[model samples]
Target: MAKNNTRVRWVSIGLTALIIIAGIITAFLQAQADIEAVNTKADAIVKTSEVMKIEGCLPSRANGNNITRIDTRLDSMQREQRTAFKEILRRLPNE
Candidate 1:
């Protein structure tokens, strides 16, 4: 009877160890997947930013200054007006 109890205790301890190991492996895999997903999103955002710059959808830098010195809302309004003026100019017939 004592031998049987010892065998049962050993089996229980082995199962518990395996369970803990499996949990660690699962957590590590999940962390790796999360990191990969974040990297992919960051890459996609960089690509989109590049495309927007190429298409002139992003803000243009000042001729002399290297930084933006105005309010963002005001700058956005100005850009909208500029785009509207360009569209109007394109629709105008040549005299």
Candidate 2:
């Protein structure tokens, strides 16, 4: 009888440990998903801000001599594309 009770106790402890482990794993996965979602949103916001900046500088982009203009829009991160475009434009031949 004592041996049977010991076996049952061990089984209950094993089950409790299993439940705890499963909860930890679930929490870890949920945290990872939340991080990925935040990262995706951040990337989208940065991309949108960059596009708006380029659009805002459209007057300077009217000229056809603007390949560097496109590259500059992407390179400045959060600065004015015109600033970089002007520098890059000077290096190119007149078009």
| Alpha-carbon shift of residue 93 in model 2 (angstroms) | 73
Candidate 2 backbone clash number: 0
Residue lDDT tens for model 1, 1-95? 99999999999999999999999999999999999999999999999989988766334533343345556767999999999999999999989
Name every residue pair that clashes in candidate 1.
Answer: none
TM-score each candidate. Answer: 0.59, 0.58
Best-fitting candidate, measured by TM-score? 1
> Once superposed on the true structure, which residue ranges of model 1 sit more than 4 Å away at CA?
57-95
27-76 in candidate 2: lDDT tens per residue? 99999999999999999999999998989778665776567876877777
Poorest 10 consecutive residues by lDDT, candidate 1: 57-66
**Model 1 lDDT vs. the true structure?**
0.87
What lDDT would candidate 2 get against the real structure?
0.89
- Pairs clashing in candidate 2? none
Candidate topping lDDT: 2
Q: What is the C-alpha RMSD of each candidate to the true structure, in Å?
A: 11.7, 12.2
